[model samples]
Target: MKSSRIGRIPIPLNNVHVNAGDPFQVTGPLGVLTLTVPSVIKIKLYQTMIKVTPVFSNQRASAIQGTVRTLISNMVAGVTVGFRKVLVLNGVGFRVSIRNNILTLSLGYSHPIIYCVNRNIKLHLISPSELEVFGVDKQLVGQTSADIKRFHPIEPYKGKGIRFINETVNLKERTKKK
Candidate 1:
């Protein structure tokens, strides 16, 4: 058995309905999500309670069961509270703006970079140096943040580039002349 798979995920304070061998449905404050678990895993659901277990004693089955449970729990939390990613632009003239659903980035480059926003995601310009990305799907939010960061990744030398709000860049020291 996978020792790391014995953890239990807490269900959010919302309505959850589970049907054996079928997809589980969760309705929360943000939205609703459905998750389908494998037949090798067994799920028990009661009023405001959910427990997932592996049918077999195999380690793979236990790991899969834990993964499925965590995924479902995250989905429920995401739909209820949503997800947000913040990005900061660090450069002399690096800035970002959103107009008509398009994100225009000027990363101290010769030409501006324009990115078309997906309908499911919402982008907000908190300031010229700050951006806020919001979406119900965690993958979409993370992907969008990565895509934006790619335009100008944080440089270790000058640390001048786009980076996540919580990201920390290790700046390198300048070498002395021999």
Candidate 2:
């Protein structure tokens, strides 16, 4: 059986504790995260290092092994260093602000769009057009940023919309008439 490349690598713990059980739990300085380990994959702890191995030598088991390893790795990283996502709005009359757990956005629309912030995620406005999303879970941070950007996605014409920090938009040229 060919072992999964990523599953063969051990995950190192840095000031983090893992409870190996039916419902696995990882605790760090930031917070604690719990996950259900798949029956096909087994999690073993060797001192500060964690290893994920497939219970069966089947292809499906190998796939699950790699996936479980990555999920656990992400959880450990999230609880330790956390995750962050930045969004920037481009164009005139674009603004974003957070107040009283509510995010207010004005994307050149008739009215402002309001989004309620999640308890686990923190939203900050660097500028009127720049927004920052912070959370312990990578999925949560990315989803929040995507939800906000969905309100005014980048247009191919004017490039006026919400985008990531390094995201670039390709603007289309205007049509010429005789």
- Top lDDT model: 2
For model 1, the local distance difference test gives 0.80
- Model 2 earns a TM-score of 0.96
**Which candidate comes out best when scored by TM-score?**
2
Clashing pairs in 1: none
lDDT of 2: 0.90
Q: What digit string (tens of lDDT, one per residue) describes model 1 on residues 1-178?
A: 5523443564544643444445676766666667777887777766776777778878788788778777777776677778999999999999898988799999988999999988778998889999999977787889999999999989899999999999889999999999
- Give per-model TM-scores: 0.86, 0.96
Off by over 4 Å in 1: 2-7, 15-22
Candidate 2 lDDT by residue in tens digits, 1-178: 8768999999999999899987999999888888899898888898979999999999999888888999899999999999999999999989988898799999888999999989999888888989999988888889988999899999899888999998878889999999
